[model samples]
Target: MIVGRRWGDAVDSWVKKMQSLVGYRTFTVLTIVITGLLLFLLLINGVRPEKYDIQEFHLSTETIRSIKTVEDPVKTEEERQRAASEVSSVYQFSEEIGENRAAIVTSVIDYVLEEKAESVESLAPMEEQVSDLKENLNVLETDGEGIRFTDGALVSLLLLENESLINLRDSLTASIRDIMSKPIRSEQVANTKNEIERRIRGNLEIPESVLPTAVLIGRYSINENETLNEELTQARIEQARASIEPTRILQGQVIVQEGQIIDREVYRQLKLLGMLTNQSSMKPILGLILFISLCMWLLHMQMTKWRASKEERQRTLLVVMLILIMSVIGMKLISLVSNNFDVSIAFLFPTALAPMLVRSLINERFAVLMAFLTAAIAGIVFQEGYSVVLQMEIALYLLFGGLAGLYVIQGAEKRSHLLQTSLSVAVVNFVFMAFYLLMTQSDYGVSELLFYGIAAITSGLLSGALTIGMLPFFESAFGLISTMKLIELSNPNHPLLKKILTETPGTYHHSVMVANLADAACESIGADGLLARVGCYYHDIGKTKRPGFFIENQMSHANPHDSLPPETSRDIILSHGSDGAKLLQKHKMPKEIIDIAEQHHGTSLLKYFYYKAKEEGQSVNEEDYRYAGPKPQKKETAIISIADSVEAAVRSMKHPTAEKIQEIVHSIIKDRLHDGQFDECDLTLKELKTVERVLCETLNGIFHSRIEYPQ
Candidate 1:
């Protein structure tokens, strides 16, 4: 017998060890997968792509000139060459004519000066006549000769016609003789005047003859020696250098040579190239994909933590994915609409509906994170500047909508709760939108305001609709028990609750008191009061199977303990918790609530029966009478355990008052603390104290002053 017991104990121990090891291994794998997903997302989103290069072209004076003269065709190559040769021939001839004219003018000036210096009196008339002639010569005509007198003249007739002519001629001759007799004062002036006269011989014709010649020369055409392609290439090369090149071939012109500053140009070119490369969509695509993946991983972890059941996990994920898809599609539709209408609809790209729906269906923390990620991705995809504002608005809407849902839908029961939540979300969104518009000083008219209001309402309604539509799928997939379902199960008319009430009235009463105590305690500790209350309602359901065995249903009847042995009685009492768990499972109760019912006793000793047996001199083990239980692992379950014990203990009091109830509550809580009943739960010492106070108040209220029923 000892060997058999030892072998059984060893096997039990090995099984527990293996279970722990498997759990640990599963957790480790999950952690690794989540971490790898996060890392991959970071690598994809966090890193930016290299930019493209652009070539920078500079404009120069030569380029401007080329552009300006591009329309003209007069400066061709052949015309430029011919014009150059003609210009050379004309220049040589002009030089020769200038030299000869200068010499003649110099000799004529010297003769006049000699005549005047030698015979000043005799040459007075001639000097006067010469001055008059010089004055009239200003308007004279010429034909490739010296100035001609307009009036006809004959020298022979002038010598014979009159004595005055002979006198004038002889006097002029004498003056000429006198001038010839005079000594020269300055040879330089004579040489200069002679050089000027020779050069001006034919070319220095009077204005009347030279004006027409000037006009003809102005019309002369010149030939250019370069083709358009050659000119363009030359211009480009010169532009590459910092030189000035002729855009057109002109006579007596040369192209200027200047060195190139490669460094400055190269830097500008590289900068442009870099800009072009940076603008590529590939980098943004990679970054967006990475960001989205990270968001998914974060959401996955958050959902995993929030959901205690597989169905809940699946539901939250589906809802989140649906929200994201809807947001993307809505943005795309808005983009298309805006483009088609030629309006600014980019503001609607980051759909506020996505995060709003997520918050309504899942939770706020995940919604906020998803909102930011969506905004960032929208900005990247749309390539619009207003994506930032859209993102901010989306985040704000998420916050408001999530708070509304959490506030109105907490411990929800009916579908009407969803409607209420939607209304709350709409109100919050409208108020926030109004505040935003006021802050931005927007010039919105009544129509615009109405439009915004409609949009906000639509978004809220959509969120609620999506939540309702998706809730069933999530519930099935994750096997989650929502507050709504819990409330429904807690109804007094529920099949199981009715069975307990009908079969074991005493246990039903005890369950009611337990529910009240648990609700008060859980609420005080900021735990799920509704879950605790409902859990307490069904905690003693197994007593219905054998109603007569429990004391609750033994009203005014003989005690069954008289017939049953202490061990049998203890087993019957202990078996109820296990039986209740089984019943809960059969009824498809959530594991969380089932755990509360199962763990309420938590292996506590059945001291009453055990000590009773001991006093009778019976050999008995205490473990034999102890309740079979798994210890409470959560705040709700721990709260339910304490409430169960305290409610039963307080009910046993002969006379209960406010002060008595307070004392009893404090004592129960203190004992539980000393016994380490709350060690596994997340409840803090302060919360425990709060729970005790609330329980005391609730008990005092329940046992409040009332007139005794008339006998």
Candidate 2:
């Protein structure tokens, strides 16, 4: 049957190879084609030239309008021509009259009084005469051409003058009064006064002469009206020209016929569209390179600190990638939903979820690192309209989420415990949100608060659930031994412990006593009592293989030590530690527990057997009788070693009491200290004292008056 089977297997192998040749070739060709297509697509989209276009627009030169430049001086002929043009368009000045007539009369009176006297005191005696003069002047009137005095005194005085003098005085007074009454009719008043004066001059025999040229003032010129469209076009042209060049130019330089086809309109449009030619393209490229390098460096640093197995590293990498992708997707969805639907939907992607899951499943340090990384990534991906609140929410959630996982799961057990942890995280998240809202005085309604609460709770719970669900896979794949697993193994009824109890009852009882002592000492020193207790349970497991050969497992009928030589007995006792470690490894026990079993003795001397051999006159090296050990590597392991020795020593004491037990425990600790058992661990003198006190108290309780009672 074996020969026939071998022959048939060889034939089948040849037939299968021939059949797979075509399939293998097809698979190889398909893989190459897919790879080539993917490369082509990457090349097309990843490397393409940018385009630039120019557009035409009108331009106005502001420099031409405001720039001061040297020019040839104007000649006398040019000045004469300009003056003639100005004189052609000039208008005679008009004086406003009516209301100011009293002011002019007052001014004339003041001028006559000032010319006659310097001060009011010199003119005081002529007050009555001045009053009479004022009354006569007030009665004067201009009837179209000449003055008419209603006062008889002025008329008689004027008639008594040489008839010509009378006429001249009347004409002058009439012209002055008319001009004062109608100052706006300056041309009419001047012409009438001149004709009257000319007539008077002829009658008086004075020479006729043209009046000196009158001082003429011209009115202001009016500007032409411009349409709105023309003004707007001019403004646009000026703006375009102003934007095209720098404002200031160097001295001694002149701009002659500046180029106007630079297409400022196209440049402005490109700037608005973020496609300007002046911008550095390398900026984004540098940023991308820096960001990717930083991310890779951070990833490498995190993996190094984690020191995880290859499988564990891969799994963590996958989970982190998934988280990053999911976070990006969630941010995109939030933007879409909030923009198109409602803003309340954005509350769903709470930053707390990522850190919570990471901390619960991974270590605390890694969780915190991931939290920071996630927050930074979320800030970049989830930014909406430059809102700092969103970034703050991400940072706060990551911080509290990591803290929640670290605090709640420090020594946690069941999956349900993570739910409790989630509740704690939710409370923290809600408080943070509420505080933020209150501080900013936001107009968030009760519904918004409710949404935040629901989001926080749901996120925390989901994170915890995911963490718990992933723990088993991570543990198995990475060969991780958690604190919870250690606690379970420490149970009295564990299969290994049960086997020790059934096969070697004495060793089992000794281990239990050691566990009690070690737990008390470790707890007092702030060490891990659970690790110490669990280590004690399996510390003497090797005694089970050869039960009768060891003193702890030897029954009353057997006296193997009496029959065996001192060297042989010491060998048997020392070999048990190494044997126990091997058995644990065979059964796939954790390395930590195996370490405790191997290092409990730590090469300590077997004094009794060594002395016994010396007394028997047998030459034996003391090193040959010592137990082989790698020594305790931690405080808990060192404490357990001492406790193991202390427990067995105190058990052999006669009539032990609280005081006696205290003395014995202290002695054992002191001896272990002197032996340098704590050299490898971080235990200090203060912690050692606390351990001694706890041991004394626990030992006193165990050996109390009640325990000494007989039935």
Question: Best by lDDT, which number?
Answer: 2
lDDT of 1 by residue, 22-92 (tens): 66335334544554454344334223333323323432222110101121123243444444334311111
Report the C-alpha lDDT of model 2 over 1-711, residue by residue, as the tens digit: 344434434533543453365453343333334433432332221222222333345342322111122221233334444444443222323333322333433433333344234324545434444445445444433333222223343322322324433333334344444443432333354454454444444443321221110000000011111113545555555554444432232222332224444355334433333333454356434543455446545755676565433334544554454454555556555655566744445445654556655554455666677677666655544444324323555556656665665677675776677677777766776676667667877687788777777876666666667666655543443344556667678777878988999999999999988899899889887676877888999999999888888666666767778988888888888899999999987766765688889999887778889999999999989888887887677787788888888778777787788778778878877877787767766678898788878777776776666545787
Poorest stretch of ten by lDDT in candidate 1: 63-72
Against the unseen true structure, what C-alpha lDDT does each candidate score? 0.57, 0.58
TM-scores of all candidate predictions against the true structure: 0.55, 0.55
lDDT of 2 at 292: 42
As a whole number from 0 to 100, the lDDT of residue 636 in candidate 1 is 85
lDDT of 2: 0.58
